[model samples]
Target: MDYGIVSLRSNGMFAFLPLGQRVISKLVALIDEEMRSISAQKLSLPLLTSGHLWKITGRWDTTGQELIKVQDRHNKDYVLSPTHEESVTNLVSEVYPLSHRQLPLRLYQTTSKFRDEMKPRFGLLRCKEFLMKDLYTFDDSEEAAVVTYNEICNAYDRVFQRIGVPYLKVAGDCGNIGGNFSHEYHYQAAIGEDTLLLCNACGISTNSQLVANPDDVSCTKCGNQLTKVTGIEVGHTFLLGTKYSESLDAHYQNEKGKPELLQMGCYGLGVSRIMAAVVEVLSQDEYITWPWILAPFKVCLITPKKGSKEEGAKPWVDHLAEYISCMQGFQNDVIVDDRDKLTIGKRVTEAKKTGYPLIIVVGKRACETVPLFEVIDSRSNKVQVLSHKLLLNYLKEVSIEQ
Candidate 1:
């Protein structure tokens, strides 16, 4: 009964509202599913690390003024990790001691990251406290690193696709983390903060930072100048060969008993940022529509007017609620809006705002006489009348199509 705005920072600390929690939970589950599909094992890392680790990697000096540094009770300097490559590498060195047999180790984690942003804005898009899904891969050779990097890139592609936002892969610059090659996954949106260039003829697309607009070549399709536009970067992967390994002395004993530095690659998906990107890219004038696979709730069931306002609705409301409950019990995702006070129109509007895939409206006429309900598909603007018995099957078929 109480709805209040939640502030992320009272004076400069992390806080969240119920809606924020729901969005984060959905994104984490979506990301974890993608990671598991690729056999990337999930691991948790400490939020704080000794400054010595950054010093060894030389990032302590080069990471600029953004690093959040603190001192322990013993006066030992520590850093709130903006990233976990060094930490993950150190942990692996202590445990796995890389061998060619364990060449491609894919590990990932979803956790809160800290950066002393000079100006954090745009709600969760740019925040001092943010959530990220960072993954690291270890390989025995540069060739192996490239292959694994591509595999992870494909996994990222699938992740965005399943999330229902159309994105393009663009060549990217390897900024602080030195690497040979990198690519960024960007979602095209009018309000995006990054720029992208595309060649319609050659099918080449890249972020403006890493792409050169070729004056020598024109669009092969129409012989027109290729257009350059901006997009929001949602994810990126880099092929890092022995950079972190050499920096951290992460060496492994070869078969001949010789020690060699392990090759490495790092992939990052801004989980929370992608959630905002989804909202920006997928929202329309009426409401937001998420891809069925990534929608927080697969279906929302709403009951129409019944009995008196205070006494609650008719018996069919309970029957329909029970039916949806049973359907969800059979592995379907459904949210029942059983609130008796809210009107049917208001509930439908709220359902659209929440980006549920399917909306089912149940009324006395449809419930008692035909046992059929009206279904609204927000994505395609299609409406259908289907019997209660066929609802689950219909949802399954439409979900697969999505």
Candidate 2:
């Protein structure tokens, strides 16, 4: 790919190059921060889970071909986990005894998940192996579990808001995850595969898959006509009350000192899928626009030709970047592109594609009486010619250069 973010492997798999990995790491960090705010504890799960665990919940056969099942040399059955409900339940229940105080527990992890997609396409959006952030909640009762579900869902809302995209929190089907109540977070885009019905009056959205009839359905919140929109699902939440816990006997002590099944819920955010979907929705015909926090670098310094007199401005840009890194704690937020063989025009074009929020061009202007450099604002596509001191002030205003 031009940007070197990801590449297609054999058929349904993809390899995320360094740039892609950096983007995923930023997204993961954001998700981790949001999860921790909800008092969720982080943990890692094995990529391979025992088939016996799925059998315990009767999902071993119910989960169609999408579930990737394999065998070891001993011929025992195992699964490349598509989800961790069964494994997490067994992990919690197998303990001698869980306590009431431990109820309302939240656990989460960001890891690779596997599924045997019949037809994978759209790059990382629908790949066989992808990164995901999944959170599981345990509570002493269904009421408490529902409360945890809403709390986590609110946290998810905060994340999407920070991502700076208008997303729909639509009522959705439980499907294979199987819970009575569920919601999906999606970004409406032309290439989206899922159909969403947006209410005309109250501006509510619901997944069409959950509605029995499209033509007959109306907004349940308000009696208004519904219009259809396509969307890419980026996140999902399920109020799984005692489904996994009761099936696996994951119990915690009650106030009466008796064992009671732990109510459960699960939340999922498609890490790679979101990265792709954000690009799908936000990128323009001429440029890629990443969310400011998710951009690989806040500023890219582009110097003139290697031997040209304009190249003198390179030191000024580098000195400023070094100062910002060493004094202001912005170590990896700025980069200097020293590919001087390429013309400044070509370099600027490539930097736009890389989605740098701000670009500093050190050209012949540095030799002028005022000695100014050009700053291009990708978000606004505006060019400002300012001297070194004003450039620093502008960067400080945008919170990028300074």
Candidate 3:
């Protein structure tokens, strides 16, 4: 479903087709649910901000050519935000009068981010523009900030687990967004661009960039043998204690009525990149092994005999579609493929390419007495003939689990 789901607009930009957008929508919904569970409020920030705001953090110069710079109609300079640290800091400083009581506030946004990548490849992995879920936390003290950091880490762990993808949390460098400490969650994929070394003895993982001696085959911390793993970075969390808060003048008053800088941390998840990374790791050939939860449509109803003057085959297909479509939980999640113009074989092939979790093809026998439907499990490549009631029951059970 490469081009069918994703269409490349330019060298580094892509537009998500309907099916691709559905996957993205589901991913975003999952992220929002987890963020809300942590009491994080969702907000929207402008896509373009004045360059002067970035200059306050000194990233305007340090970010180099990756920053997308533009000019306003009145000649004012602005940059497409690669992140929202400076913007969020400014917003908090202006809106939330800083107080110790207001400390440990978490705010997040899911928005489009821009970075002029020199080489954008591997679909959405390194695109110039992509969707991101970035969260910022403010606190009163460094000690309290670290606690909040751990909480966020736990929340991230829950998210990755819910996604059902294998990942590793390893020490990472805070390159452009400067911070004292950070951790990156990498999803194991053969096509990944980053290399990580995992300790065989202790389960500790380290990014190759932080390893002092790359040629060494042992973990420096445990002196145990290490195995190299290649993975795509999907999430990163940073403990930015007063970095942007102090620089951006986000000051809060302590209990003693003394002005203090807000301790801060930031977490980022590449929303669109997660979709692409999942595709890279879970898909084979043209079939995408969508985690049941992430599938665009849980079930597809194929009417191979549409427009035919057969023994009520098309009518049977319609009746089945209506029955499945009206099911309690799968109202909008079922697709009725009534395109009879295409041959039955071609329709089934196209549906398989879309990677629906379940494909139900209603053939001529479906109109006969004691009807049975052919159900295809896209991931296992297994076909089963089952009664209509059994197929519906199975779909509902799977949907409820997701």
Candidate 4:
């Protein structure tokens, strides 16, 4: 609210202001790049899906009220998508007869989803409407699907590792999704609602809900002592095998030219939930931090304070901003706080709270003979005064190092 990142919009919904939208856009770009690296094809699905498809998958009745069910003018039932397993499987069934040569096919989409939460709270963490990235894979056999599963898990780990956050992947139950194998990716945070049981002896992590008897907790792998930890779930991958494909008759032609159910897997990444969870994990007392790749702007160039002695430095500040914006890492990702009406102190404080990684000040130093600028590295809270040539080189070096 203070920095105009987001505006309140009813319960469980947020209106992303200019700054917030910029961060979301950068996050999407990073996710898309990773997906493409895995040879996943991007596509979109409708928000409203026919209840008939859900019924075929046996989830229409089992999903209960949490699934947002509705009806149209002709009295045909429909549902607002919580996930796309049923819809995606139904679509693939029509395009059947995939040859053995095209063994693995991956399709994915990033889109808005709807779920009826009993109580919506904690901003985007548990929301009625939010954005998500879901990928579905079809393989010729269970052996092949298992290989793809490991590859997808590795890709997921890379995403979090690049963000420079501490995260863990733990075994999870299939529950309503109805898969024999499952894993969840989480960021450890104090506000996390889910409890994880970790075994030190065998280095195993299991979801607390999966513990059938809390009084007798032990690692399923090594029969060792387990301790509890809290974590916010950011992503989940399910090795669904033939669950959806068999139910929906989604199949491919085998080497013998016989129809066989396609081995399938589904993976989900909560975009909005990760955004909220990252802030919860990285924010410090009075100041926020962001993943380097997800920051709204790489640098915030602050002009002289209103009516200050350095008012004559306007031209130099503008010139500096122009140069930084064209730099390799910046690529026009730098912004100038030209609101000269506000005090320089106030603007710098605002930029710090808003999580700009770098802040450059054009004050008294800018009016000096050599025209030195004050550079503040907000990420490390370090300050330095350097000449024009040195300042540019310093920023360029920082980008390369990252």
Candidate 5:
């Protein structure tokens, strides 16, 4: 199974291979659409920023050694932004300019972020350069911030659910951002790196850093000792309040014309990391079973075991193409594997390895009969033969649910 020029060596830094790029792109589109539905205006921010911005927020010295630093020809210092909190706050302050009318502003960005990692591994999960979707909200008061925070929280939940991943919301430490409340969305997996605490009886869950019992001795639910487990942190939301605003002097004029710090919140979802999490959670044995909504290719048409020129393989190829063309009319992207060299068994194996949701087998009989195809569900070993006319109808029904 050679990928030719598309093959990637097992290196730590180069996280995404050819197939990974397709997976990541689909996930980004899914997440972006969800964010847009909630009125989250997407903005692109710079990958590098001046050292002064970091100094203003005290991150220049305290963010540890992961900060990737550089200098211009004139020796001006710059740092690759790990997160866009300060940059976003500075932009908001400059644009809105202390007007109470502009309060409750929500802005988000999806782009590449950088951090010089001491050790980068596990494909895109812990890469130094990766895609991230970060969001920031500005509010007039703590109450308003809470409201917006909860809305964003629900939005995150919906995003993950739509992508067919079960996520756990757990309390988290405020860390350097200095926030009163922080929650991390963890995808439960055995290979996850972060530990979480949960009370099975009461359905209470929290990250180990923030877990606490009333008596500090037993679980609050069934009076049993809490169990600790490891999970992957896929997303997080924090109530930053005036932390970044005050650090960057982002004050707005209140009703009395007095300068007041704006309350702020930050939410982050690792777009590339989510790709890794998907593989970690969904892959079984030799291949991956991507959720139909997040699969890079919805249908992979394979004409394995090509017939001789006299046997008339052209009709099967044309039939498959025509079917896919009709699907494209409905705005669905389908991949047709028309290579005449590959064997039927090889094509089937490759199609499954690529994690396509639906596989359509085209043969000579398929071109002559009204029911010329068999549909294979990649997740389960289930196959059904149906009429070509019924194929589109069934796909529509399943795709809608997906």
Candidate 6:
């Protein structure tokens, strides 16, 4: 982060540098694609909400002291919304009121949320403000609600897998969210705050908070002994049933033309938390190597030593970098280290610290003869040489594989 990927502001908040923002954009794109495939509509909700909405659902007091409330010039109450359930539910009721045809509606928003954490730590893990992707689902019946829930679970699984993190879907507690059931997606890490128990034989996992005897529990499916591991929660899904709808008076007309409470579910992914969790789990020692899809740049091309023979090919290196930047997937993402008078070792070290997936070094031999590029895989520390003519093909294949 010394390269300005993320700049620390205080105990719980930070600013995303250009590189950091690019990674977040890529992650959001992937998630947006998945959510749109499942017919979820994206919308933005206000960051500040009226206290009346919170009071309607009794969340004004039940939401705890972490909630930030403010008074206006007229002494009217407002809240820096920690969640958007009341606002969205009320909005949807006004937009599409009491229609059986619009029963199973899915709406989501990707925005910053706030909570006055008493003790915020671990950067984005526990923050007073963070980006969150919260999705709300409305269904007419329990069966339809389950279908929507499973669809969201599958989408969340794809998201984690594509991000190349080893995450587990474990049984989770509903807690104050007021849901019938919940599931959490956890990324295993030694520095994580949450403890989870896993069964190797049956692949069963559960959060320690939800288990009665987490230390001595056996897998109910395979009778295997459980192992405890620390994990960071990156995503959570709740089968809320009618918890929010009934409390907020969000009712719809059914096939019988009778008013019934919508079966509700909420899914949340900690967008900024995922960024920090990726660093926590994937960082080797102090170096950070991100997956291709989540990396700010997939390739970094470096020129040779300024005084060396390889410096003859500096123009060609610059040309190749520009050409690569115009390609479909890597547009404007090829970082060409063209700093003059820098040694090859120093340039490579600086580039390595920024965590590009692949690095290509144009050295003396390649510049003098066959014009090959020495490619280095940052994550694996593997090296390979490829000719200029084959660089695009190699990138295409790598992109397809990732």
Each model's TM-score, in the order given?
Answer: 0.87, 0.95, 0.95, 0.95, 0.90, 0.93
- Between the candidate structures 4 and 5, which one is better when assessed by lDDT? 4
List CA RMSD, all candidates.
Answer: 3.7, 2.1, 2.1, 1.8, 3.1, 2.1
lDDT-wise, the better of 3 and 6 is 6
For candidate 2, give the lDDT of residue 266: 91
Please list all clashing residue pairs in model 5, or write none if there are none: 98-252, 305-344, 366-372
Full-model lDDT for every candidate: 0.74, 0.86, 0.85, 0.87, 0.77, 0.86
What lDDT is obtained when candidate 6 is compared to the true structure?
0.86
**lDDT tens string, model 1, 1-402?**
002113666323446565446666777887888888878999999999889999999888999888999998999988899898889888877765456676678999998888888887666666777788999988777788788887888888878877766788887887665554799998888867787767876787656665345434445445555667778788888887777888887877778767788888888998777877777788787577665555656677887654644233355556665666565322446667767578877887787776776788775446445567778886666778888678657865775566
What is the TM-score ranking, best to worst? 4, 2, 3, 6, 5, 1
**Which is the better candidate, 4 or 6, if ranked by TM-score?**
4
**What tens-digit string does per-residue lDDT give for candidate 5 at 52-105?**
899898989999999988899999988888899989988877865568887778
- List model 2 lDDT by residue over 166-202, tens digit each: 8998889887656557999999999899999998788
User: What digit string (tens of lDDT, one per residue) describes model 6 on residues 1-402?
Assistant: 446578888877888898999888988999999999899999999999999999988989988999999999999999998888889888876754568897689999899999999999888888999999999999989899989999999999999988988898898987775544689999999878899989888788888897777777888778888899999999999998887788777888877887888898999999989998998888876688787788888888888777887778888787878888887778888888778588877877777778998888888757656778888888888888888878778877777777
Please list the residue runs of candidate 5 whose C-alpha ends up more than 4 Å from where it truly belongs after superposition: 1-11, 15-19, 176-180, 211-217, 220-222, 304-313, 324-330, 367-371
Q: Give the clashing residue pairs of candidate 3, or none.
A: none
Q: What is the lDDT of candidate 3?
A: 0.85
User: Candidate 6, which segments miss by more than 4 Å at Cα?
Assistant: 176-180, 221-223, 304-309
Candidate 4 ranges beyond 4 A from true positions: 176-180
Q: Model 4 clash pairs?
A: none
Cα error of candidate 1 at position 154, Å = 1.6
With a 3 Å backbone cut-off (N, CA, C), the pairs that clash in candidate 6 are none
Error of 2 at 85 (Å): 0.3
Instruction: Give lDDT for model 1.
Output: 0.74
